[model samples]
Target: IDGGLLSPEAVAADPCPHGMTRELCGLLCGDDDPAVTVDPDRPVGFALALDCQLAGDSPELLDDAQLLDVVEGAERMERWASALRTRMLAVFADRHPPGSSAPPPGADSGAAAPVGRWLPDQVALTLRVSLEEARCMLAGAVRFAHVLPATLAEWEAGRIDERKADAIAHATSVLTDEVAREVEARVLPGAAAAPRRLLQDRLRRTVARVDPQGAARRHERAKADRRMSISRSDDGMASLWLSAAAEQTEASWRSVDRLARSLG
Candidate 1:
């Protein structure tokens, strides 16, 4: 098998790690593989081979090695996606000031400026995963960074309540047209991107105002409860257990419970 020319059928015949579908594999492989062509009928095999290479194996897309490779690929994709988003945002900020009250002179009166860039081949080379994986990452990052940052800023400034912040965060992830329009109307206009120091100050002030005594006590408790311990199991595996005190544990647990409920 040339590995690159193998069909989606071939990939389905021999599935990659965790039995990833051929369609997903195709998304992961794109056009970077020298032997792989962009025939949709034969994309999966190439994707698998590319994934295998990324997993650090000489042979392409080993079945047994798929899990580790998938995890590594996911992590790399996420990191690259975040980096791409940050870069794209910087570009956008440079091109258009954050707080432009005046609208762009165009047909669309109330639309956001296009925010992302097509990934060049050179940039894909710098990424740890295949070009296709990199693209998926970039898409996700752009969505999150663009949608979530404004709501988070509002939350930090105490302009929006936590419940509202949570709603905005959740909606930002799933919102497509209507939500985007709403954000453009309410949040985007007069949205001046603050400097890092100013942002941090706003966050601190908001958090303090939310619960001054609780924040102080939490800070003090965190300072007081730093400890580390190391132990070895009989099976010859070493284990490190780092723990905080009862107050910290309780606080963390409560936070987790709240988050879980919110997600639910």
Candidate 2:
């Protein structure tokens, strides 16, 4: 299923109207050739050709290594953009530090809180995002720049994406700065390629190992906030949410299940 490039002579002989040579187009559609049936496991060799064609450029025939470089280059650019945003957000927070008492442009300063309580509002208006989203972004930026310098450096270097860096930041946010750095040292190396859930699990494990008492304290605080609620959707369905101790939640779920089955 490895894709092969046509020789210059072969490409010149059977040029396709679609810009690609006939042999290249056949990689996408093999209905006429029984031996050239599509391979399910392999990526189509000329997949990126369509992008180039759509961009109004003649497709340059690329080998597998070249295609890989194209994808990696795009990802690197994305990481750079994320890094830039992080730096901008951190700068924004710094300029509007607590007790700035000056409203952002297009905002009222008459009733501004003594502290920089309007930071989220400023971010939301500037970015056209929800207040919650703005707050999360600011928090992540703060953590990235101040709390987790190594993670930030990895992200800035394009070694890891924003999500991986944020995952590390959030996981270590509860630990002391020194302990967080230790956790980062242990987990940051493999984080770039780890699946989100696996990375989160590893971060939690590392956090618990480094700060067992803090983890226990957090669990107790979380248990204190346990409650339940239900919300109705427009589709005539209601969703129930439970936040309780694990054992109690499991017992309640079993009771509900048993009652429902009895009625059935």
Tell me the whole-model lDDT of each prediction, alpha carbons only: 0.47, 0.72
TM-scores, each model vs. reference: 0.24, 0.63
1-264 per-residue lDDT for model 2 (tens digits): 234455556656765456344434555455364122222222222433333232222124454554555556456556766887888899888777766666555657575564456778878888899999999898888877887888888787777888888788888888888898999999988987889789999999999998999989999999999999999998799999999998999999999999999999
Error in Å for residue 169 of model 1: 16
Quality of model 1 by C-alpha lDDT = 0.47
Give the poorly placed runs of model 1, Cα more than 4 Å off.
Answer: 1-61, 99-264
